[model samples]
Target: PPARGPLGGWRKVPRYNALCTLYHESAQQLKHLQLQLAAKEATVRELRGSLARQQQQQQVGVGEAGAEPARSLVESLLEQLGQARERLRDSERLSALRVEALSQEVQKLNQQLEEKNAEIEKMINQPPYEKEREILRLQKSLAEREKAQATSDVLCRSLTDETHQLQRKLASTAEMCQHLAKCLEEKQRKEKGNSDDQIATERSNQVFLQLLCFVHVLLAPEAFDSRDTSSRFRVHTGNQNHMHIQTKVEHLRGNSPGQPGARRTASQSEQTSPPADNGNSGSEGRAQGELRCPHCMRFFSDELSDEFLKHVTECCQ
Candidate 1:
């Protein structure tokens, strides 16, 4: 009977059954030859016994002519026995050669069987469908990995471009800030120079006013005499008028944005003088009438003392 293979089908071993049948046949033939040789030996033994009996008969007065026939028969039996032994020897040699050949063939068959069994085992462990599925899975995984790599490369390039754009924007912003800072510095420098020029002009005006006041005091010594009350009062009023003008000038300078410190210096330099006597309206009326420009001949009221002084300084010049 044929064996079942791993796939539940008949397993075909080529020439195995034929070799087994040939070996059995060879054995049977050898057995049959042995039996035939035994039969031939038994017949030879019977012929010898018969030939011995004939010799005894010849010794008991048998004829020579009859003995010659018996000897010829015995010679023929011996020749037949020798021929049977030679045939048996030939059969045994032939059987031996057949058995050796069969043994070699069986060894070759066993090696082939082992190879077939190995192939069957491999099929049972891993089928064709399973191998194909594994290959497909690996191919799909490789494709997915390649797709992910491509996406990552795109993202990296985009990020690099974005980073470069940000860097450019930052550089432009920094340059604009630097330009604004330089402009601001230049504006501040110009403002400082203008403020300094304004301060110098104000100081020169203050010096000229002081020189004019000194010249007027030197030319009118009798105006400050204590014996003349009306003259003393008028001089005090004029000094008050001068101080009021200085205070107004300091106030205007103080209000200016560029001359914040000038007010303090002007206030520190202001002179303190005695107040005038307010008991003489008649004297005040006469003093106001006499307050006339020496060169321009313009009469001025007491309230317009700063204007009057400016007119007198201009006339003197």
Candidate 2:
């Protein structure tokens, strides 16, 4: 076979096409990754808000439970006060009955005194019975009158003491009730404030999440155009498919005149192509395998050990 010119590399189209296909597929994968990253960021934002809300709800539950003791105490106190009120009412009723009974007793005593006096007068006016019998009856009636008077004094003192005690008890109960009512009002106010704060906090968190979601949705995915074009560049050379493309180019450049720039560009393009002429395998050749990770500058390790190969395969995958 004769030496071919530089432009005679179309025979290597299969290999060049393979490389172009690989680059396009890798680019599409990168685009997919960018989209996934955006989606993940949005999800992370929502998770953060959900975490905050869950914490707040947990705290609220704890606070409500904590408040129960004080509320229960208040309710118990109110119950006791109710019982006390019932007792006081009963006491007042009993006192009123005692006072009425005392009045009736006094009236009966007055009537008894009058009757005794009338009986004595009748005995004097008639003067028809034995004097000894009349004197005995008068003596017994006087003793009974003295006992009735003492009983009336005792009843009056007892009633007066009970009335004073009831007044003091009523005043103390009223004060206690007022204190409890005030405490309850204050507790309710504090709870209201806390609830308002929690609600505001939740609303703010919701707004934040909404903003994050909106940004994620509205922001453009990474532009494929911005990526490096080196991968897309298909450099045909003489070695690939043994097409002898460079030979053809050289023959053309030599036979044709006034095409030095095309010859030089073709030459440079061949020099820069991957898999430089070397005995080493294309992948093992550092000149061809020298890929700089766009994200990091670390050189890929040479080791084909299980771990290294696994990591590289996984990263590419």
Candidate 3:
């Protein structure tokens, strides 16, 4: 039995050993698979890290390739900014010049406006007058003054003509007086020695003196009074006529060298004395404005006496 028990146990042991061998092989394969999986995971991590590094290297190469164009674009943008700044500075300078020109023009206009204002003020400040009327008044006054001057000149010319006529009359009267004086001197020379001649010379001298006084009174009315001439002439005219007639008779008779001169002396003495009654009658006749010619007994007016005397003197001459 014991030997038989040993043979059964050895059979059980072979079965059990077979089971254990199968379990061991399964565990070993699982462990090997796990180890293989862990190893693959590790390999996968390394490969991903290596791929990331390769992608970073590829991106660095691309950035290096694009760098030149980006730098050129930045340089062009900087140049455009510089050009824009220069254009802005030029525009500011032009604006300043235009402002200065406009300021000067405004100042000139202001000065002209001030001058016009002053002229307007002057016109407003004065008093008013009529320009046409004032001019007419002044012209009228000038015309009146000119007319007065012309009239005065005409009056002066007329007065000058009258003065020339008066001077010519005075010259003629002076020539007549000279001729009468020469005639008297000749007569005195012719009758130098006889007493009767002496008496005649004295009477002629008296008549010459009276005629000179009468001529002077006629020429210069301012020298003597004229009122007494007519009355005095009337008183003496009769005697003068009688003496003249006697002188003419003596001249016609012709006195001889032996004859006495007594008749002539008596006649001269009688002529020298006048009666008072004759003077009274002459005064009455003058008062009545009756002038008579002693030779012809003709009645005449005092106004006609000057013309009558001129006729008598021409007849005697």
lDDT of 1 by residue, 1-317 (tens): 32455653334354767878888998998899889889988988887777687779778976555334366777887798789889889988998998899899888877766776677677677878998999999999999999999999998888677556544544543454345445434544555657555544444343333334434432443432435654422322245645644553443334333546755655454433223346444553565333555333456654565886787766555
Could you give candidate 3's per-residue lDDT for residues 198-276 as a string of tens digits? 6445544444433443344334433223244443332233456456434433432334323576356445544554443
* Candidate 1 collision pairs: none
Q: What's the residue-level lDDT of 317 in candidate 2?
A: 37
The TM-scores of all predictions, comma-separated, are: 0.37, 0.21, 0.25
Each model's RMSD to truth, in Å?
38.9, 64.3, 52.4
lDDT scores in order: 0.59, 0.44, 0.50
lDDT of 2 by residue, 1-317 (tens): 22223334234445545555655565565556556555655655565565566668788884333322244654565565556556555655665565565556556655655555566555556655677777889999999999999998998888677556544544443454345445434544544555534433232222222222222222212212224354322223236622433332332223112334544544553454344334334433443333222212223432332443344334333
Provide the lDDT at 35 for model 2: 67
Candidate 3, number of clashes? 0
Return whichever of 2 and 3 wins on lDDT: 3
